[model samples]
Target: MAGNHQQLLQLTYIRFVILFCQCCAVAFALLYLRVDLNPWATGLALLLLGLLNLITYARLHSSWPVTQPEFFTQLLADAIIYGFILYQSGGGTNPFIFMLLIPLIITVMTLNNRYIWMMAITVTAIYGSLLVYYVPVVTALSEHQHSLTSLFNFHMLGMWLNFILTVIVITYFIVRINRALQRQQQSLIEEREAKVHHQQVLALGTMAAGTAHELGTPLSTMSVILHEMRTDSTLSDEHREDIDTLQQQVQTCADKLQHMARSVAEEKDSEKTSLATELLDEIIEQWNITRPDVTYSVSIQEDLPPDLRNTTALRQAILNLLNNAADACPKNIEISLRWEPTAIWLTIRDYGAGLSVEQTNTLGQPFISTKGKGLGIGLFLTSTTLAHYDGDVKLYAAQGKGTITEVRLSRRSVHG
Candidate 1:
């Protein structure tokens, strides 16, 4: 993000230079044409504009906040100054009236549509007012100087036509370019999400393999104890039955551990299942074990339709939210899951320190986290997963209160 800002600033500086150069070029052209304006006044205005452009360029190069409102405020000021120069040189009769399109073009490219429209309206008003005030002055000056009335009228008409045509062309291309850029940005975001998901899968597989390896010894010892108890000759019939039951229970646990290990081993090689209930359950159980001090409660709606229940990504996203809630409020974390006709909703409520307005706004953005030791991947990944399935995650918080994170998935049920 910082790099992107730097790039934008660089581009802005280049634009400033380009505008300055264009102003200089226009001034030179006017001098060559021997316009009626004072050469000294035009030269002075051009010099002032060039100096302002340099200042803008220097400021953008500095480490100051590029998005600061003041930055754009100054840019608007510079644009107005340039417009005034054009007005002074020829007013409505000036061939340079079409140059007013430059600032409007820059505004459209750099700002939101609403801001662009506001600027357009403002420029139009300014231009119209200038024309109204300058038309009679220009006409009087031309007549006093014995200038040809027909030629002056023709020039004025040409300038108006040029201004109209330039505005139409600039607006059309700017909107088209903005839409194309938006699509490219969306594509880049999707690609980054895919990479992050793949990375997470690799990390989970590694953790699972390590956990399975670590649990092997304890399961083996339990198995040996059960074997010894079953073979003891001194055991009574009732005792033997109890021992048999104990052995079966131990065997079941061992089978589960082995299955987990196999699953981890096959994670990279095997295809993923559409239904992720087992995976979700395992994740919850693991979190329960890891944070035994935390009281965690999860309620999945029993009537969840097949379509909603079958989405692996949605399950993982819900699990991530649950885990984040548990981590936030270790002593009292509650998660509830429900299904509606159009969506599946998972809410994780925590009694920990609530987020501020700023944090809430940037909740799922990368590197924006509230926890001290948190890598901040949990919520980001969950948000990304939800987005992939045409879903959303929302965080609500109040002052001195807790946070409620709601994950909403599009599919309502797995029944379909």
Candidate 2:
């Protein structure tokens, strides 16, 4: 009932109309037709149902996220109240006998399959009992009922038409409303995930920047120490060689850190001049260093595509795809680029453990990953970033033994 809480409100309103209809029907029988029965008992029975509806509304208004059990209980009350009313007011002969179908129809639209069965069973059992034990409407009515035979045909026809119309209209509108509610719920979930993703990215960036600042001083100290050791003439040749290698590695690390610092300054400038080929080349070179154990290849047209205005996001998204392919099984991977006037297409195919039919269908859903210990963020973020560029990613099973991931960005995404 987290999602089905609205059922309470709907039932409350329907119950109100039901009470009004019952009271009016009873009053017409008593005043016009001079119907005979225990007026006090019947009035008391109707008042109880009205009170039940009011009590339900009051309780549900102050509370929220009504539970399924609670909803079931309230609906069960409707069945019981109507059953009691049916027994009192000439049961099977009551013109409102068909009204029992209302709760069953509402159950189908609102409740689970099991609850639908429950409503159906409850209403059917109560209605069947009415066939045996209910007072006859003709028996209860006074002798004036015998004189109005001429108008009964038209009156019964009108009532039947009214019932049909009410059932059709309510069922159609309620089903549509339920569908709209479901779509809204899905959108809300996606929006919440997006907010969480933004927070995670920001927090990760802050942490990385802080770590870089902290590591910079130690890397500088190592560079100084290694240089001094290499310069020491008293050191053995092998020791001096190791020191030189250490110094070179430290310098490389420092250069990378410096580039990281300078990237922010160069972002706007790089956007204008960095051709797509050059951008891909830079990413490949960086990936090669990170994953030297795995063999990879790249193929594309001779003429490169143009650079994007904001290149980092697209570049990072591509790298993430490459990383996913590499991680799938690090044997053989291919990156192919295709460009046309309308869009840029980049396909990465890995000759490794591929996805199944089911996995491919739900490829981009957040927190859904096939690999062990995978946080499932990389692809989610890649898809998200590409979405901002009016691009999309598609995953397919390779012809033989791997996965083929394709990315596409419209022409506007790669131009200023």
Candidate 3:
């Protein structure tokens, strides 16, 4: 955090106006009132005060923000300038002497008792010194009270009371209100970010559905072409095996798209069954076909729960994780499925050129990714998909030089 540089700048401008008024007051006493005063001494003092404020502002680099101590120092300067004005006018008898409290009021708004007490002591010392020695601005004849002097004194006292009361009221009530407002602003920012994240996830789901629809015809054509090539008479035995593998992979993709379509149509069946194989098995088979370059092993607990039945969604999310792992570590990957009493835990460990622990932990954050060309949407969507089922994904550094990702799902998701 920059130390309140914005607030400091704002206060600095307000102080300039105060300093300007003090400078003008001295000029008014000498020229208009024709009072006996040391014009050059007081005039030069006020000028130096303004110069110090300007210097302080100039010294504030964008990188080096003004701190609490620096802000306190500015307030101290204000008190000193006010003290100088009082000394030339009439010591504690100056009409505008209440301006010294301006510094104290600012300190109340921005600093704690420790600094406030320090300021109080400093101002008290200056006021005490002004009482001992000061140049009188008003003549001795003018100081002698006239009938009009009593009325003028009453007016000055009223203004002083009003200024002090206003400062106290604002410090007590407005400071607390401002703090509450800041908290509300922070909450609104967080809520806005969450809404944007949710919208991005929804848009990703829509795009996936549209892509599945568009690819259906092209996949069918590819399957037919592969089938015809397999039937050719002169094809070698090795070539025939490759064609069979390619055909099966293409058919698996088609089946996955069909399942995704069914889920989208909201088929209201409480349960679903596939020919002899479970949903989890079908997912693994499809994933294995897609990631043919990497070797992966899966382990299941003794009494595993049934699949959540929306295999395409979960399958696609896990596929994103596996694909990310493959990109990071191509040699080998290990997947472990363990069943807890209330939850199911799935872990994917990769052993290749591993990323840093900090890098892996931030895998699913929007716009942040470990991959060179990745846009970071894959892991974001994966995390969002798992969150729908009351699940979470976490990434960690492996024991050696690799990354490990663990995903946990509430048991109710599978059990339901």
Q: Rate the local accuracy (lDDT) of all candidates.
A: 0.64, 0.77, 0.73
Candidate 2, which ten residues in sequence have the lowest lDDT sum? 137-146
Question: Which residue pairs clash in candidate 3?
Answer: none
Q: What's model 2's TM-score?
A: 0.55
Candidate 3 residue-wise lDDT at 330: 64
lDDT of 3 by residue, 1-416 (tens): 24256546655666676676666666665665556788777777777777877887887655786688888888788788779867877777666667777677667766779989999898888878877877665543565443457547644864575476446544544465356547756878978977988988778778888899899999999999999999999999999999999999999999989977887576445245332125456666777787778887777776746445454566678778888888887666888877667777878899867778688667778778788899878889888878877898988878867888898877677643
Top lDDT hit: 2
TM-score of 1: 0.42
In angstroms, give how far residue 248 of model 2 lies from its true place.
2.1
Top TM-score model: 2
Off by over 4 Å in 1: 1-148, 210-256, 259-307, 311-342, 353-388, 392-395, 412-416
Ranking by lDDT: 2, 3, 1
lDDT of 2 by residue, 196-240 (tens): 878767775687689889989999899888877777889998898
Which tens-of-lDDT digit does each residue in 280-391 have in candidate 1?
A: 5656776666567778676776763334443444545676776677667776777776767677676778898888888888777665678888876678777766776678
Best-to-worst ranking by TM-score: 2, 3, 1
Candidate 2, superposed: residue stretches over 4 Å from native:
1-150, 273-310, 323-332, 338-344, 354-384, 392-400, 410-416
Give lDDT for model 3.
Answer: 0.73
Better of 1 and 3 by TM-score: 3
All candidates' TM-scores? 0.42, 0.55, 0.44
